[model samples]
Target: MIKTSLVLFFALLGLNLFAQERPTEDPAITYANTITVEDLTRHLTVLADDEMEGRETGQPGQYKAARYLEEIIKGYGLPGVGPEQTYSQPISFISERWQEIDFVINGSSKRHLWDYYAYPSKNADRAKVMTDEVVFLGYGIESEEYDDYGNQKLEGKTILIMDGEPKDRDGVSYVSGTEEASVWSEDISLKLKAARRHGVETVLILDPNFQRNLSSARKISLDSRMHMGFSEKPADNYSNSIYISSETAKTILGSSYGKVVKARKRIEKKGKPKSVSISVDLALTQQKKVKELLGENMLAYVEGSDPVLKDELLIVTAHYDHIGRRGNSIFNGADDNGSGTSTVLEIAQAFTLAKEAGVGPRRSVLFMLVSGEEKGLLGSEFYVNHPLFPLESTIANINVDMVGRVDEKHAADPNYIYVIGSDRLSTSLHEINEAANEKYTQLALDYTYNAEDDPNRYYYRSDHYNFAERGIPAVFYFNGTHADYHQDTDTVDKINFEKMARIGKLVFYTAWELANRDERIKVDVGVKP
Candidate 1:
């Protein structure tokens, strides 16, 4: 009887074992597994090498970087977007240089570097020599209430003006507010634009402050000769803008300088418009060269499997451009963006592999390798303004920048990553990220730089800000600032490849979840300035 009972117990245990089911596998984990450290290092090895020449914007090095990225995505079998089905988006810009500046006021023969300075107009394309009657148009501010050049014959003429708008008796500004001056006074471009709109051939701005800093201004003028401005389409207005000292102004105004100075004081005391006429022959000779530069923003897309959900999109971005070489020392920004650029390529490969294996996300993914990020996020800005895909259908942007090296704050902690702008426009995005990290990567998601008042202003610094400004939720992956940031020392030997891979996997998981979730992540948080 004991043997029979034991046999029956064994039989019941066997039945229970057979009836049990295997646990379901998470797709996010499987897809994220494709991002490997070896792959990231291999790509970074080529991208951050000295041969790339820092990937400067509009330079041959930048074009090589673009080709490398284009070929990379093409290898993944991702197709290009739009009718042309090309992977490159063209961006035309004007690079200006100050070739020459010759000015003679009342035969005094003002010096260039010592007494006066001038720069080629932003829209200047050819050399121009202007000889016109100089008219003192006060501050040259024109608006509904204040018109300094009102009804004045300013067409085909030169205008002399002063810096800063008219202030009240208490030094308060009515154009802006009681405490601060308006955009007219603070922004030089606005002042120049106003002068050009008046059909003025030249604008001589009497800037005492600039004159005091003439030494610094001369250095700045030489450095800024290669200033670039976007010119894909036609733009209006060109004024040969010059900044002169008070002494130069006096020489041009002759005996009328004292009266003009007194009138300026009166306007400051009473907050009134004081437009005067200065009779002087102004002649300027400037040899300007405006070279049109063509830049390309790389784009490639992987189609989603789900019929209905495939319309929604997720974007991954990283800038491949750097500060270029200063002299012979190359600013090889390996960690600044080379790490992020490699991480993006790895993420794209992982997504492409998942799609091929029939475990792809429901939503499409667009990989963008942009240029001109170091120059002020110009590539991403252009993308958002003129997107290949509809901005509305795009749910979020995952931007990676400077994720290779550890900063002072994270030196002691290896398992850390800087998470910015995750909660700025969407609470759901923040929660999803926390859940994904907890489930997969346990790296500490530091929000130190996410504070609205954070001095670094990390949110507005990266390419993600462009999407966030358009109300699309974004997450910026960073390792915080390091000593070698923006320096020539940010080399490939310094990047933590293992840590970079972990962060890349974390991004993959987030994108995977965002792309395949039952519903899109809701924009539930208010955007911060």
Candidate 2:
């Protein structure tokens, strides 16, 4: 009897160990796999179709696209935000373009691109500004070590300042007392803030390399820009500034030009501040043509299963608007953003499925498809400023823009995606994404564009930036740019649906881990807006 009992007990123990070691499939992977190429292709076909008219913001096509997204999220049974629980968030913007600008110095009109360039100032009291006797503040450096204003009353006066700070012979900076330039030299805003502090009406920045930079500046100045119509002007706003070449500076300074140059040299050598007064009659005239338009951002919320954690939110965003058509040619931005929109839609569906299956996330997931990204990330900006949920409770944002076609850099191996702004705010967020990719997708996560000094500046170019600016951790997924970028040829046929599906699944998996985790990821690093 004892031997028989021992045999049964051993067998039972073996059975229990086997059961404990058994590997059950994760529900996240099961749902993530549902994001297939067929679904992505189906959504992309409708989004990138020629009938959409390129889906420009504030246009008919864009409105149609917003409705389509709204219908999809509503069909998935995700709850909407705002009064009446509607999916649409209306945003108004003003489109302004410079109609004409005339800068006359000493009764001689200067050419716009060749001699001078000025941006439209929305806060200007009038279209015309005339001043006599300009003040030349050397280097515009205002600090305990050096003060250029020096008790002078510069209120309502125009000031001229050089572009860069004074540097010593050994390449050391006089302001910082080191090789690295100070904020006064690196950021132009500090100088503008100083000017605004003293109630200076106008500022003229003297750029010795103005001609070399003219081409790029001219292109940006000529393009019409958009601004929020509902928001108040920023406190640091100082837009009445003109970038002038040395020739124009000479014209304004007259005989004082040589003395100004000598003063700059003396400051660089002896670390002394100099303020010079130059008498000149300057008259500036600017006219802008303004138009008002409205756009929509679609939001669908999936409430979490956990009562407490449901309050914390995870946001997934994509821009639905593309550049409008030119004449008869349609800029069907398939790879530009249709892929991203489709991905967000599919991810939303997957989460909805999870909710239906009683395995939904612990924290709420807000799926947002925004417009005006092509214009200037205006939709995200509006949402951040006017949030339905408190910004403090918002944990993170995952933004997808252009993840369809592969770029030239990844031609040899097209199975790669650029991951930008991942580690900028939260190291834990970066690790979560990396672990997700390694465990599931196995795609090459490229951080080339995440470099602080990257020339492309991809981190700041997308909607993710608006969240990152407000100290929220954000990550941007992209497939880089291809030949058909912004071209009419960026059609559905060029998109790799299989690759896009993989990327979508990656986003889904990462979001799943983020939402269901026991604790919210810490913001180890913070940024200022």
Candidate 3:
């Protein structure tokens, strides 16, 4: 009787497996194979033009750009995303104006607004700290294998450390153990978590030029304006941070720890000892606070042609908003992302044109242009937390950041494109990218950010990083950094439209193939950097 029941169960299981293997439908093809550069340039001109005032987030100009994108997409003739009417998914967020801050070192006091800056932190409420004991921890780096503090207690003490992990030109921090170098590329909230884990409270990163040589106070301030609840791990008992000059660190850690600034001769000799102690007394004064600062991310979609594949989705994204009017001079983010958003519009047009021609993609595509990127990838963060589409059905995302300008290395060629993070996650996506590149636009695909030990950490910097963390395959298209990167002079006039078109064409083609391919790009599990 048992044998008979086992045989029956096996037969039923085999029958079910057979049913699962049944072929449903062929691959999807959404476009009519007729997307041109001229159409792309038209959208690029209006979006990247200086008249948009760099399309700063939450500014009137960005709203105009979003409205313009809506109008343009409407003319493309695809079905609306939401049930109501137009193609918009509003992501709610809050903005805080850090109107007041006062910090002092060695009897010298300065306001954070002018002397130091503070980006908003992703915390529940006001995280304040008064006079506290500060400790000088080298790099504040901790590892189970080789603890920098070496069993020394760092609890309830402020830490002074260097900027980044120790490494060569290649990004290999060469330090063994993951604990010491576990710093992530998200907001300052993660840093706070790291501090808490290391048994430290207030942190004073002494490295003046740590992590892109960015100002610590400024980076922290920018991160604070982000939406609440963005972090997987909150800032626990740890809070309050600042940066002091190497000169100031010397005064703080001079006696037992030696001079904060090391001499060149020290490099020739054995490195200094690992641990030091500090006594810190910080009193942060709050002044009159004012206006709230924040931004928004725009979302849209085009459905798939095939019913089964329609369940799956593809994401094409870019950051539309730039730095708002700061002083008399507004930071025009034309090439930074206006070009990216404009290119997305053109891609949408191409997809809609194909759909009208009865060749719409098999898998749906969601077009997203986010804000608060200049303020530290805020718009993308908002979307990840509150997605318009289900993340499970989302297969992949292709993010375009700055593809308008010719890279310094390819200034003369004008036909090259920088590809980052495509092969980092999914081997299948990497194969698809290479195959698409070969079949479509033949621009050079540079992977300067390919090395696992690369210093820039490009994989974690762009909007694509947000998608990748969710296990979705993603690619970041950049023209590589140039003389004007993050500078006010990154004007549209300097952008190589022809080069931009070529890069855009590559993006359009890549998305076209991925949207229509028989099998969706496979996710590579177990791969880690």
Q: Which is the leading candidate under TM-score?
A: 1
Q: What lDDT score belongs to each candidate, Candidate 1 first?
A: 0.82, 0.87, 0.66
Looking at candidate 1, the ten consecutive residues that score lowest on lDDT are 226-235
Q: Model 2, 466-498: lDDT tens per residue?
A: 999988999999998878999999999999888
Candidate 2's TM-score? 0.62
Per-residue lDDT of model 3, residues 367-458, tens digit only: 88887777667678777777777998899999999888876688678778778888867887877778777876677888888666889887
Expressed as tens digits, the lDDT of each residue in 244-287 for candidate 1 is 88778878888777878887877677766776677776667777
Candidate 1, number of clashes: 0
Which ranges of candidate 3 are over 4 A from the true structure? 1-34, 95-225, 229-294, 527-529
What is the TM-score ranking, best to worst?
1, 2, 3
Better-scoring candidate (lDDT), 1 or 2: 2
Q: Rank the candidates by lDDT, best first.
A: 2, 1, 3
RMSD versus native structure for model 3: 18.0
**For model 2, what is the alpha-carbon lDDT of residue 290?**
61
